[model samples]
Target: MASSDEEKLSQQKEILNLQSQEVDEEYSKLSAILPWDKFSNWINCMCVITFDLELGQAMELIYPGHIKLTEREKSNICYLSFPDSNSGCMGDTQFSFRIRQCPGRVKPMCASHINYNHNCPVALQIDPGHYFGYVYFRQVRDHTLRRGYFQKSVVIISRLPFHNLFMHMVGVIAPEYFDNGEPSIEVACHDIDQWPTPEAGATLNLPLMGTVLQVRVPSHSDKPGLSQNLVVTTESAFSSPTIMPSVNDSDVFKCLFPILPHIQLIWELVLTGEPVVVMANSPTVCSETVLALVSMILPLRFCSDYRQFFTIHDSEFKEYTSRAQAPPPVILGVTNPFFAKTLQHWPHIVRIGDHVPATSNVKPHKLKKGGSLKTLDSKPGVYTRYKPFLNKDKAVLKRLVQGIQTNRPSEVQSAMLRRHFLEVTQSFMIPLERYVASLMPLLRNISPYKGTPRTRPFDPDEFLKSLDFSGPQLTTGIKGDWIGLYRRFFRCANFEGWYNTRIREVNRKLQLLHLEAMSDADLQSWVSGREEVEVVDLILKIKEKLTTASSNHLPVSKDVGEKLYKQMDAVIYTLPEDLRAVLGSN
Candidate 1:
């Protein structure tokens, strides 16, 4: 009797200890919900631009000023040029901003405009998130003439065949300049024309690796301009920022790696729905890093619209020519003085041109056995070979996820963790998607035959063997079993006609239930201990329905029904014995 009393006391003590722990957990969770003021700071909008540049190139930003301002009123102009990174070279790209005082006075009205008293409709004002600008011409007297807004599609198409390269360069470089509290930027014609041209005078032969030039803006008196066209010149001997010299792709990545975290931070802090554009003339930039970072940090919609990249060299130019096409000439837009003349020794290094054409001729031996085949529509030598890489990447990702879960990491890792994670995910998605697309033609399709639905004949097992299903979520516990069940239901069958019909029916009903349950957020509740009817109970209910249908003299056979029942039972038995017995008996 004394022992029984002691046991009861111990049981009560254990119950009380569990309750205390639960209460403490609840309090900790509540504490994590910060007050309203803390989250308010994250919502504040900011704009940012991230420039990807090489050693010699530089972007010059000339802010618009009131035309009426005299030479004395203009702010102190700083003429800056960075020194070469290597011996007698300007390599590093730097970021700097200056505040220009706007002239307060409004411009005098035109004499014709004063007499007519008409509103000026020609002014171009772009919306906040847009990135491009347009111009339309019209006569003043035409009654039918209407104003047209700039269409992004038209602008993009017009810029092609070099559109791809130009836009990609813009995507990488423009964000840095325009993310400063502005939705859009005025991409003027002069801006494109004024790209730093290679000139001997631009380079400063300095001992230091980094150089910043501070000079006064040349006044009108220095040049005495405004004769026929605009020829604004810098009074100081120094030139605008020069383009960076050509380095290997690996070196470019290394230079940009440290700045990625900061770039992410800037995007987070500055972005408040308004898009940004940064202006810079980078000679060589990595498209992989640029697109990956944009997809991760910006909204997903940017992927379709903003993602672009430029490549100076095409590895497989021959494959492209089979479609009866000619490559565009590479246009060297950089008027920056030193780029062309100084780098003449490097013939292999074509700095920036839209078209440097290559021949598509192939040797007769590579065509076929004993020269039997002369031409091939699809080039076997240059086809997309991505499946092997996709499988490898998927396997590595699965291992990475397993490692993370097993080790259980602590917070306070490096800031680049998120960036790296994004890079991996983006990198995996590209090749995997390509591989899947390549297999689409081989996928079986269902067709109707004599008023009955017939599934196309294919070896489901063989197809499964070809696929790489190593994704972490697709390879674990219940989810993994579900995938196997889907595969087996199609591939494995004792009775072809009856089993296929019944199993398909059951599959459809289960799919509907799953969609409904998931949509209503009741999937967890249905499977939880609190629910009287679990998934097994639902399966049993389906079994009862099938039994009833069979009794009505349906096409389904008793043996086929029995086989499916066994399969369902197998699934149930895979669970804990206690849960299975309770659910199965029901």
Candidate 2:
């Protein structure tokens, strides 16, 4: 009996050993299939991270995947993969996050598959829950281009449906600019269903606005499906409520992440010489989105192009379409007829028209040649290579110049001056001050760049060597101040050197329109008769007289002022229709 018992015990021991060996083999297979080293490399390259709101921890351990940027076939693409857990409770709920890449293709899981597969093609399963963001591609400078190479990095996070997996949250690890310089997202979800309530300090190391990220999660009483508000605070020594707020409250899954990227994309397109037309269907989201996109993105250049089209007429639609023809690659929606006419010409069409479409039809202005009304070119940036604000009436052009000098909107003028200064510095080798002085010839009734036969133009090489911007005081000035200082170096350099610019521009238009030769009596007759003459002869007569008096240092008489006022009043009443449109009724 004893021998039989011993044999049975030995058999039991053998069975235990076999079971242990099977368990070890299975673990080895898991390690091989789910290689930690490869996963770690991905995390390192993309800066992948996860934060636990309930635990107050920024955990970077391997977690379930949603979307990621990865290299494929020597090009970068977004890879969507799910995380499989081998450990503790992932949580009680799950959330799905979606991202849309512009110019970059999205390869999603197969339609039949429940989850994303590593081997399938990229395509998103677009449905109700998917919120979208944009990715823009901009070129970096080589040796010649200034400001070094241009690099864009953006991080976008959209709210998700709830799931309590081992992982809490995931986001793109992009360069700061892509996400407006915020890389990590600290999410504090309130009124969550089934999931554990987040503690006050659970989310740490969040990307701060000024210096430090401060998160406060209020205690929630035991309840399910009750809504909770997420309060986020980012504060620092330099942070203020205006620039950097102390508290931010939001819904459990609300998003305001569209503004940064949309503006960035629009600016990138415009500055790089791309065509963009924005039309929205609805007034709220569509119109606001377009406005927000163009508001601060190169305000001087882009603000005018962001037209609010409530409804479209045939001619207005035609004009809208004409402005979008060729050269710059990017094109937004025009009016109906315009969009329909130019549809075949657009290389890529982004249908945002559904957001903000034309609401009403507008009668198009009648076309005129060499008249007061200025026509926008099929390709903008051309004004006979000499003049700007093209096709403006001589009388109106003169008034615009006078307005720039006498009643200038200082802020707008300053911005315009800064833009011109930057344009010069980007291309010319001379100092900004010298460039303005050279342009003084335009004000002095001479050439824009060169002087007349008797006087020599400002030498570019000599001026380049003479620039003394080495002083710290001079170097510390902002763009507007620098332009102001440049203007101060020249006589009548108001409007940041643009005052004289309008003078030369209007004068050139007069010469081209053959109105410069009109006599004083003939011009007066035309002004009184409303003849749409080639030039504002009275204004030019006054300007030339003013220059002569200045050169001779002669004091002007009160009679001169009276004559000017009388002529202006006569012209104002008989002003061309286009000029009146610009000036508007008092």
Candidate 3:
């Protein structure tokens, strides 16, 4: 299969060369295909962003499969593959996509090696035909051979489904402009992909926003769903009880996970010198359509974070096709054509009339993914880029198998590893320590780096031992100040892959023990209560710390802000057994 793909890629390359000659023969006709320049810019940006997200797959393991990045190379032809075979890829769910940007940007090595910047608008083109380079490109024409020069600004994307609108977990390869200095960059859609107008005759919203994932968190004695109360939001599209907690008892926010990658894919295509349709992840999983989901996942701060992360917002929906969210209903019964997100009053999935099949058409299987495999030039990366998230947990759990003396209690090996990263690891302790330390030198006379002034152990086993582990406590400052240097450190960096390493330990237990035996309701209660304290404290301290440093060190705001962002990316592991495990430690 691999060899066949490689050979086909070689053939396609030849075909493209042949086509280029044809293009030259009828340059005017071929060039007039679309707003190639503008579209190409969009595609380039998307590819860069998608690549960036893949690199950020750090502690994804502990969160089940929530931390995911699926990628395949751009081939002369497009082929699709399923990262997870769909049998509960959610809550352990996995999915994937193959993207072809402005074109040439298919290989990971090529993308990784691009000269990156934080200031220039990242132009990442996966366009093999007129592939956009990580570097910028501009058309330069004379009476002679026409030429394209790399310029700043613009990216492109493809492979975005239109049925749903929600938060996207996109990664970006920012042109030097948005680099802010990180390897990857990102953006998000306020909601799922809607047709330019759902009323458009004969178009089917191929992707359903909630199918990819939608958990119906039934309103119980303790929890409630949305009530008919009007709420408000801070910025962008819409505001609801989902992002912001309201006093209403029966309110629910059908929040969607940020669909960052979908946007990235679309932008990659736009950046490619071609005007193509924008597709998103399965519409079923988009935020607006997720009629049911854990309300806790939809935080306004995360929904509106593109400003801080992407440094810009240029998201727009386009036409595309895919499978429906769930089984469809009678054409007449499919009344209100699904609603989208806050970005607009109403958006519908757009399709080029011809793309739609008979209203009663049923697919062999749900839009069977990997359907696009016929489009590949070369079989690409393992999509294992996020493997670290899972592997780290596996490695740790395996290690714990040796240290733990417990006998197998219903698959103890697997149980202990579940939800490990989310609830157990001290993800940011050290990097955060260093980041906090860096702030220390700027805010006070104490040097952040040790030796010359305070050289250090980097993360000495002995040094960690010296510090007490019982608190998000405060330390005495130069005078009467109650500083949280250690606490701040704990939140800033994910040291020793501690978050991954530790979460693996706890998840094993989660998997091994019967969930019925332990009280998930009790656990949920604790999470709800503990979340109030930790979240409030985290947001407040973060805000306060930033403000304090802003006044004390204006010169370091950028650096400090980045440090804060990193802190947020660090996973918080406060599970039921985590503290107990700490206490049991000798």
Best by TM-score: 2
Superior by TM-score: candidate 2 or candidate 3:
2
TM-scores of all candidate predictions against the true structure: 0.17, 0.23, 0.22
State in Å the error of residue 328, model 2: 8.4
Q: Whose lDDT is greatest here?
A: 2
Tell me, what's the RMSD of every candidate?
A: 29.4, 31.8, 28.2
Decide which is better by TM-score, 1 or 3. 3
lDDT of 3 at 74: 30
Q: Whole-model Cα lDDT per candidate?
A: 0.28, 0.30, 0.24
- The lDDT, on a scale of 0 to 1, for candidate 2 is 0.30
Which is the better candidate, 1 or 2, if ranked by TM-score? Answer: 2
lDDT per residue for candidate 2 within 329-418, as digits (tens), equals 322333233343344343322223222111123111111122111322222111111112112223422432443446554333333333
| Positional deviation of residue 523's Cα in model 1 after best superposition, in angstroms | 17
Ranking by TM-score: 2, 3, 1
| Ten residues in sequence with the least summed lDDT for candidate 3 | 304-313
lDDT (tens digit, per residue) of candidate 3 on 214-331: 2111111211122222122223344332321221111111111121112222211111111121122332222221211111211100111101000001111121111333211100
Model 2 alpha-carbon miss at residue 46, Å: 56
